[model samples]
Target: MNLQAVKILFLKDLFLSRRQLFAYFAAGLASSALTTIPNPTVSFVGFLLMITVAIASGIHLIGTLMLSESTDQTRLFVMSMPISLLDYSVGKIAVILTTYLIPWSAMFASSAILTFVLPTSKHGSFAVLPAIFLFLLCAFLIQLVTAVVSESVGWTISVMVGCNVGLNVFFMQLFASPEISAAAKSDSVSWPPVLIQLLTVELLIAAGALVTAFIAQTRKRDLV
Candidate 1:
């Protein structure tokens, strides 16, 4: 791998993404403000707002950093540079993932803090927000891998739709399950065996998809 070239490409993407980065932080701050309201119903709405911000920011960044590269002119410009395709792949993935994680982590930490501060009688169920964040991150990873590998707008859109629908259904099922609901309400954080197993599977899928994408990039003959 061309480490120097990778660094240059990464810096290029990072520089170009600065505007989107600022917007993401602004959205995160707005969501945090909403969550800080003392009303339980309002806070719940705010939490939903936070989720929307996170997902939208992720999609926007993916489009800017990954999907745009698939266009003919952009592909030609990038390929004309000194970097190999592998360097481009590593740089784009690293830059996009790192950029996304910044806002995601900030929003997640704010949500966790808000959940903990919420009154037990009103919003104690917010404890499950962390688990929900994990699920969301898994979905983001799947979308990222799909964009990087397939380079097809249709596949990416389909994955986004499936993830959004599936995540809502999964959370609803989790809330409905007696054991999981009980765990969510406990005085302390509880990682029930089932929750642990589910999270493990998600992490595995995400990791596998990322590794597979890198492998595919290495073998790819056409940069365009």
Candidate 2:
């Protein structure tokens, strides 16, 4: 594996995503500010906005970054370089994960903190935010794999739509579970085994999808 090539590819991807990165940061800051508002209704709106912004940012950034090579007709230029398919895959994965995770984690943490401070009667539902985030991450990974493997704009969009809809289903199922709902009622951080197991599965699936995508790329003899 060419470490230098991987680094170059990663840096190039990051550079291309710099503008989206700025918008993500702005969204985070705006959401954070809204959370600080004293009114309960306004604060709740802020929380919802934060969730929306985080999900949208992840989708937009990853979608654009993954499709950029093909959309811009730069795949041939990139393929002509010293980079291998594995290296390129690893670089793109690293770039997208780093760009998406940091903001998502921050937003999740803030929501968790907010849940801890608010009354259980009103804010109990918010406690499941982290688990919901794990599901979102899983959904995002599906789109990532679609982007990496098919590289078809239409298929990628379909996967995104399906994942978005699936998110609601997963959220409802998880939140409705007695164990998870009970965990959400706690005043402190709760990491019940059930939730932990669920997260582990999501993480594993994401890792597997990434590996599969890398292998698929490596086997391709006719990449443009």
Candidate 3:
């Protein structure tokens, strides 16, 4: 891959994505604010908010990137440049990851602030970090899949939002079950299994996205 070309593509996408980035940040800040309220269930609420922020931000970023290419007709210009499709795709992914890192850091910082201001235990805050990271990784993978498969902004947004919402609902029900709740409430709960499950799901989503993107790129006569 051409490093210089990748850098150029990255910068171009970064500039193009500024407005969407701002929207993502705004949404994250709003969610964090809503969830930071002092309450007995603050930990659970905050964790959910962090997941929501990550998923929303990922969806917006990926949807906007994919849609903008067509809407702004940047696909043609970008494709005409001296860069491989793989390089361009890599650059886009790099830009997306970097953009996401900002909101992820914000979520972490917000959690830290809440932990300090509230009566949450240090162990609780520590536990949240890994969960947030796993949720963000899953969200990113979902967005990557939507980006590759969607042809329009609305469709992309729908897929991203639908996947996140559906997963959240399903997981919430599973975790909130009487038996699971009892186990989770206990201090001796084993998180490794949950973490492994999340990792496996994230990997599967990422693998599907890679396959879809590869097939789409291969079939297209033009690259962007």
Candidate 4:
């Protein structure tokens, strides 16, 4: 692999994505505003916003990749290069992480600020960290799945929105309840059960993406 070429491609992709960083900040600000709301019944709402922001940010990153490749005709150029497909994939993942870290970090910091400023009888700021991590992991995994399945921008966005909406609803209904909130506060929310559910869902989504990426890479020649 040509390390210099990879570096150039990485930088180019980063520059393209930098243009969308404003949208990310807007999402972070929106999440921060939601956190500032002093509704006791809606303490979990901030976490919901956090999860939604993470998913939206992931979708935006993936959509940017697909859009840039198509718009600049860079996909064919990258594929035509001598670099291995694995290297290409790694470069894309690197770009995704670099582009996403800003918003994800902002979400975390904003959540911390909200936790302090908002009126919550319960102290669960530490719990927010793990939940944010899980949300991002799930978002990326879902992005991989959508990228493999959707050939166009419309389809990709539709699928991501649908999947993310469904996941958000499920989490809010199942885990964001007052009962669960109370449990989380007391550390009585059986860690084993919560971990099992989170791990199970995340692993399933990630395994699906890994399988799709493997299949896509193996058939790259055919795809071309």
Which candidate number has the best lDDT?
A: 1
Candidate 2's TM-score reads: 0.87
* Cα TM-score per model: 0.92, 0.87, 0.72, 0.71
Tens digits of per-residue lDDT, candidate 4, 150-193, equal: 44676676767777676667567646655445545752223435
TM-score, cand. 1 vs. native: 0.92
In model 3, the clashing pairs are none
Whole-model lDDT per candidate = 0.82, 0.77, 0.67, 0.65
lDDT of 3 at 63: 59
Worst 10 residues of 4 by lDDT: 187-196
Regions more than 4 Å wrong, model 4: 1-4, 37-52, 112-121, 125-129, 148-155, 176-179, 187-192, 200-204, 207-215
- Which candidate, 1 or 4, has the higher TM-score? 1
Query: How many clashes does each candidate structure show, in the order listed?
Result: 0, 0, 0, 0
- Candidate 3, which segments miss by more than 4 Å at Cα? 19-23, 26-30, 40-52, 112-117, 121-133, 177-195, 211-219
Q: How many backbone clashes does candidate 2 have?
A: 0
RMSD in Å for model 2 = 2.5
Q: Tens-digit lDDT track for model 1 on 1-224? A: 89999998889899999999988988887887787787878867877888898889878888888988876458678889887888888888889888888888889887777657756432445556656877888888889888988888889989999999987898788888787788777777666677777777878887987898899888888878
Deviation in Å, model 3, residue 207 alpha carbon: 4.9
Q: RMSD in angstroms, candidate 4?
A: 4.0
- For candidate 3, write residues 25-47 as lDDT tens digits: 77667767766565647646766
Model 2 stretches astray by more than 4 angstroms: 36-38, 116-127
